[model samples]
Target: MAGVRVIVTLNFPSPEAAEQAVAGMAQAFKPVLQEPGALQYELFRSVDNPQRVILMEHWASRALYDQHWNKQMREQGAPDQEQARALSPTFEFYPQANYDLVDGIWQPLDPADRMTTIRWA
Candidate 1:
């Protein structure tokens, strides 16, 4: 691994709420429009069970990623904001691991219910 990739697994109160919100996110449709420092960003919904959501974020650097995570927008405002209210997300960033990708690509998934998953390596 070379750079930093933050893998955040948000545990919602229920699988249904998680599924509903994941389906409801029109704002999340575009990853490129997200924060500029994000080298890559992705979303996932558990296949066996829909409640668990995964977010993978690749940053220009670990420090940059840390900065982005600590910023008020992500820590405090992400929940209050309109695009994030439906999503009761819990986040975590790495203390170590320079997330260099061997293949440079992540898998993709499309669903009929309420989930969109994108991958980045």
Candidate 2:
């Protein structure tokens, strides 16, 4: 079976700080991505979240990914994605959603189909 596309977002104090974090992250996930099920991991610093970062990852299967999250306790031997996530960071797992329903992949808003406000319900 295929896997899910997870967007892990983070924020920094300033643009300079974000840049530094991005660089640090580039080297941090080296060992992580090498692990099983960690198919692909990409880091992105958003224009909106100048002080923030995003991690787009793809896994071989949700089970393996879940194992990584549940068992990857640096407490045992693994590494924390990094030490920067302690700053009010959170994650949302939308197992039902992917880029298919969304038109543009990276750019969420398309000028041709832009809407003023969005309502979840």
Candidate 3:
């Protein structure tokens, strides 16, 4: 089975809010790095627009992703997510875009029409 890739864009009111959100999320999700099925978790900030942040997560399977959330919400009862959301009233979480890896190439799961080949420099 192919793995799942999740990308989310967060638009904050200010750079300070964006940075705070990243720091809180990183600390909150630190345990996710050891979670089963967790492949990659990366946070990025736009150079031009410091208030824009991007969160990228990869999981071994959709099932694992769902399970992770269920565990976090039900079993762990973590409130970091809620706190992060309170950072800014204008904080926005754009719809998450989920993709799948096909033979190491990433492609949108819904359409699977567009493909992205990543090359590390």
User: Relative to the true structure, how large is the alpha-carbon lDDT of every model?
Assistant: 0.59, 0.66, 0.72
Stretches of candidate 2 exceeding 4 Å from the true structure: 75-86, 96-121
Shift of residue 38 alpha carbon in model 1, Å: 1.2
Candidate 2 RMSD to the real structure: 9.4
Poorly placed runs, candidate 3 (over 4 Å): 75-121
Error of 1 at 33 (Å): 4.7
lDDT of candidate 1 over 1-121, digit per residue (tens): 2345677676666888887767765356464336556776777989876777887877766666757657736555655555454555556664333223335643222122113333433
Q: Give the per-residue lDDT of model 2 (tens digit) for 50-114.
A: 78788888877778788777766643665456654554566655432122334434322434223
**Per-residue error at 24 for model 1, in Å?**
5.5
Say which prediction, candidate 2 or candidate 3, comes out ahead on lDDT.
3
Best by lDDT: 3
lDDT of 2 at 4: 58
Q: What is the Cα-based TM-score of model 1?
A: 0.52
Which consecutive 10 residues in model 3 have the weakest lDDT in total? 87-96
